[model samples]
Target: MSELKQTFNSSLGKKLIMALTGLFLCVFLIVHLGGNLLLFKHDNGYSFNMYANFLTHFPPIEVIAYILYLCIIVHAIYAYILTTNNRHARPVDYAVHTKSPVSFSSKNMGLLGSILLVFIVIHMGDFWYKYKFTHSVGYKEYRTNLLTNQTTVTDFTPQTADFEHSQSFDGDTEIIRVKDLHSRIVASFSIWWYVLIYVISMVALSFHLVHGFQSAFHTFGWVHRKYKPIYEFIGTWLFAVIIPLGFAAMPIVYFIQSLNK
Candidate 1:
């Protein structure tokens, strides 16, 4: 048991933990971006609200949400530890430090991570914390007619403040009520400074993931030469490009829509 503990307390163990947690968070980013894409629908946020409602109220998803939060904290902490230790171990740089083509992100992971951490706090505080703990987010009632396959949304007022979400059927129509997190999103994205910050953070995210994703695989000893190219391609294009652009597009589109309104 002491030997096992010592392994995890050592440097390699720290890197392994970071690898596992980082990959988990990467999967989460894909899922999260997929869900957030519903924000692009023009249905007055019916689909988006339903998605938000399911995530917060569903038992299994709630458990995963907590796990995701813990992983983020652990990943950040371990990253800071490794970064500081490396810096102290070599306090002076070599006059001719050889740089890898991908070393820009490798060297700046701390700065990129710090930016992403700030963005996550601001984002969760605006949406997650308010939706769960505060009444800052209003309510919406979405009534979908089964016959017509259409949904109409209206403002909802709960009889009790404790109410979070509800679902029911009235004849051929489904009545769903949930916190109006969609409106909160629109309100947030409408602001120019917020959009700027979101975009900048996504750029940082792209750089961070491009390096980190590939490194995570290498850390796990999966560095087969035949599959190295596949890992690099997926890491560079998916997490580093598509995911960040997908997230960045939401705010830009929403802000543009707000300008027209």
Candidate 2:
């Protein structure tokens, strides 16, 4: 216990924790982006709601969700602690301001991370809390004709008194789907202000990832003369550019679709 405390109190230990948490979040981004892409199915939210249902109902996934929540909290808190420590250690300004070899994103990680944290809270409150804690406003029932193979969706609203009983299925023939969430997402994105917020937040996320991905490798002592450039390229293209752009695309696409309607 004493040794563990000593390590955690040291600079390297805090960095290792950040690296591990950052890598875990990177994996989460891939999974989350894949799920978000389901919004483009044009199925009136059946696919997306079903995906959301599976995430919340699956026992293993629920456990993982708890861990993911913990990781987010710990990562943010440690980041604040480390930033404060660094600032305290350098209280005195240099005699002359000099250009830093580190990139701008690298120097502004704390600010970028703070922005991302705010975005996460808004995101979770908008979706996760509504879906998990409160009853869905209603669901859509998708019915198919057996002979013609034609499909139709009907909107449903459960009795307020029986809201707790609302589910994704109504009976043997009716396939009740959660439409409330899909409607919420679409409506939220339709508003110009909301879409603007999303776009700006994703830009901040891109900057954060640009520095964080490569910094994680440095924290792990994995950076080498031969592999440094390769790491930088991967970090720039995959994490910094591709991932954020993928996320940013979702809101933009949906907002455009909403405009068309």
Candidate 3:
């Protein structure tokens, strides 16, 4: 048991754990992005809220969320350990300037990761914590009249509202419903500073993903010299699209909704 513990505490083991958990978090990010994209498809206001409601009711999914939380903690701890170890290993800072073929992101992953960690804290506090621990005032019970394709907010609980009267709309058949989801998200980012923070955090996330994605694969020994190009391409793509689109979309969506109003 002591030997096992020691092995787990080794640098290689720590890196491996970080790689696995980082990959897990990446998968989580993808799923989260997919779900958030549903917000854009306001077929009726209920589509997104209904999905959100469903998520609240899903026991299996809740379990997965808990596991994800654990993975996040483990990843964070491993990251700190790695950072401290690296710092200790390099007691002297190199004063000379050197340029390598590796991307700038690859060299500054620790800084990027720190920024991402701060973003995660704010993100959890703003959305996840509120959703889980507190009731949202923006949620209104609605009933959707399927025959007339009309939605009206009724007197029932938001979670219990039927298909009809459940949707909200901004225009005629445009389905620009001002939902609780929208309001909460919009309200959070409405502050200019929050928006700025979100943008900077997204930039950090982009850089972090730029390096972390392929680094994880390399840590796992899944790639070789021939596959390096493919790995790099996919890593860059993930950074180029996933990070910016996922985080940036929130502000942009809110801004568009504001302009429409």
* Among all candidates shown, the one with the greatest lDDT: 1
Displacement of the residue 206 alpha carbon in candidate 1, Å: 0.3
> lDDT tens digits, residues 1-261, model 2?
999999987899999999999989988998998888998898887778778877877999999889899999999999999999998998997899889787889889999999999999999998898777866545666675555655687877655533432344333444544545777898788988888888999999889988898899999999788999998898889888888898888788889998898
- What does candidate 3's lDDT look like per residue over 1-261, in tens digits? 999888778888788899998988888888887787776775434567666766766899989989999998898888888888889998989899779787888789888888888988998888877766666525645555555776665333445432222335444443322235545776776676787888888888888888888899988887888988897897788665665767687776666676676
- Score every model by TM-score: 0.94, 0.90, 0.83
Q: Determine which window of 10 residues in candidate 3 has minimal summed lDDT.
A: 158-167
Best by TM-score: 1
* Cand. 1 Cα-lDDT: 0.93
Quantify all predictions' global Cα lDDT against the true fold.
Answer: 0.93, 0.83, 0.73
Stretches of candidate 1 off by over 4 Å are 92-102, 169-172
lDDT of 1 by residue, 1-261 (tens): 999889988999999999999999999999999999899888898888878888987999999999999999999999899988988999778888565765788889899999999999999998999989998789999999999988888999999997888999999999999888899999999999999999999999999999999999999899999999999999999999999999999999999999999
lDDT pick, better of 1 and 2: 1
The local lDDT score (0 to 100) that residue 85 gets in candidate 3 is 84
* Candidate 1 TM-score versus the reference: 0.94
